[model samples]
Target: MKLCILCAKQRAVLKRPKTGQQICQACFYHVFETEIHHTIVDAKLFRRGERVAIGASGGKDSTVLAHVMKQLNEQYDYGLDLFLLSVDEGITGYRDDSLETVKRNQQQYELPLKIVSYGDLYGWTMDDIVREVGLKNNCTYCGVFRRQALDRGAVMLGVDHIVTGHNADDIAETVLMNIFRGDIARLGRCTEIVTQGESSIRRSKPFKYTYEKEIVMYAYFKKLDYFSTECIYSPNAYRGYARTFLKDLESVRPSAIVDIIHSGEAFEIKSTVKMPSQKTCERCGYMSSNDTCKACVLLEGLNRGLPQLGIGKESRVRKQIAESEQKELPTVVQHFSQIQRDADAPDIIQPRDPSTVYTPPPRMPTGVLDPPTKKTLDW
Candidate 1:
């Protein structure tokens, strides 16, 4: 048997991808937890007596994160009050099973657990949404809803910060996806260790630099109680492509994941390019780029039987809304005519009585009284 490189006493169990050093299982556990601790300390992820929530999905990444966070909190005397926050997407078999795992995690880790459901928050389940929207872009709805759901869940738990299980591989894959889609804004932020949206609770990824393979190996060797199953509703074809590409690159060069993350961190978007401005959703009062948040827009579509409303380009959705409003203009104009108008704009004609308005035919310009069409157009 190969001897452990670090201790040289125990038998080697695995070779680290980040550093191709053969180490024993005990050494692997220590280093894995220590690196995450170092990442947290270096980034200053938490403070004394701060209430934090672990965005636990019961998956290997999240499970390992929970284990490591508890270990570090106790060992380093971080004085953190930790809780497990989970979002139930209302998937029948998928989230249901995963939530059971989260419950078990709560008991095993002895942390307070809180779960929020999509059906309760948005009045729609993933099943209902998939049926209404079909499988084509269901992931969009799920992603948008899940983000807001997590924030809401964190609020319910009264956490100051939220930690997620996003690993280096996930960050690298997101970087590739953002670059491929030309999403300059996301590309710039995808590599950050912490992200605070408009929500009060700050969200961070302590495992931002940790490798997924190492996480799996850690869980396996430690025999960590965690769930290992793919989301039933997640086809994730687009991100899957990026993930596959990144994994393939990793297979050839183990450092590719960290390198991509570094590249993403190095990106400096030009100041000239306009990025989306954050605003509160008019309907739900959630953080959104538009007047209405994506979740609200999508929920409106589903409720109005126009499920395709927020699926595509924002311009296209706006156009559809404008066209629909135009189709009902006569009724709208009649309804609004009862309201008083400004006295300064007496020339502003109201369409209350169409027949009372005088119509003029088009006149041909012939002299100095009328400017040429080309000259008018130029002006």
Candidate 2:
């Protein structure tokens, strides 16, 4: 029987993808959890008495993340009040079943669970969206909506920080995707262990350096309950291709994932490159680079029966919105305006009319748009 390289006395059960080291179950769990703990400490991700929300998707990464966060919080006496925060995208079978797993995790981990749905937040579910927009660009709506959903959920939970289960493979894939697409703004921050954006509540990736394989092995060994099915509506074709390529490279060299992340980290954008400045969405009061947030723009498209409004060029989306404005589609504008207007004011204060909502004008920032080239929208 093969013995663990680290323990020498125990039977080897798995091989680590990052180092290709044969390790026993106990040693594997120790190293896996320890590495994440180190990442949290090195990044200074938490403080005493801080309320943290784990962005649980019921998937392997998130399940393991919930477990590790609970374990380390107790082990290190971090004094953090942890909660499980989930976004119900309203995907029929997929998200529904996955959320059940998150529910079980809540019971097992003893963390307060809060679920925010797209229907409640946006008046549209992924099911309604896919039927209207079709499969071509539906993911765009889900992606944009889900992002804001998490933040909104955190707000309701009153958490100080949000943690996601983005592992090294996911980050590495994102790094490659950003490079291939020449998204300088995203490439700059994609490798960051923590991303606080302009929102008051910070969001971080504690598993930034952990490998997916180790996370799965850890779950397997510990018998952690998690959902493994992929999102039904997720085409994920573009990302899947990148993921496959990264996996192939990993088969050849285990260190490729970490190496790519390091390379992404080493990249320094030239001083001349202009980046998008963060601004509050005029419609929703959310952090956005454009005059309006992407979610609001996409919702406008769906509500107006012109689903293509925000899927392509910003110029096209603007022209469409302008044309719609000339036609006096007050319903479309008023709906989002009301949501944003109500959301902007503190909960303690009563909401006012949409007309009374005031947002500061957009300001120019340093980052340049992708050089004027015909590019296929990822959606």
Question: Local distance difference test, per candidate?
Answer: 0.76, 0.78
Q: Name the lDDT value of residue 101 in candidate 1.
A: 69
Off by over 4 Å in 2: 325-379
In model 1, where is the ten-residue run with the lowest total lDDT? 328-337
| Cα lDDT tens digits for candidate 1, 63-114 | 9999989989999999999888888898886777667667777878888777
Backbone clashes, each candidate: 0, 5
Query: By TM-score, who's the top model here?
Result: 2
Model 2 gets an lDDT of: 0.78
> Residue 187 of candidate 2: its Cα lDDT?
98
Q: What TM-scores do the predictions have?
A: 0.84, 0.86
Clashing pairs in 1: none
Q: Taking the tens digit of each residue's C-alpha lDDT, what string does model 2 give over 77-149?
A: 9999888888999988678767777777777887778887898888889999989988878887887888888
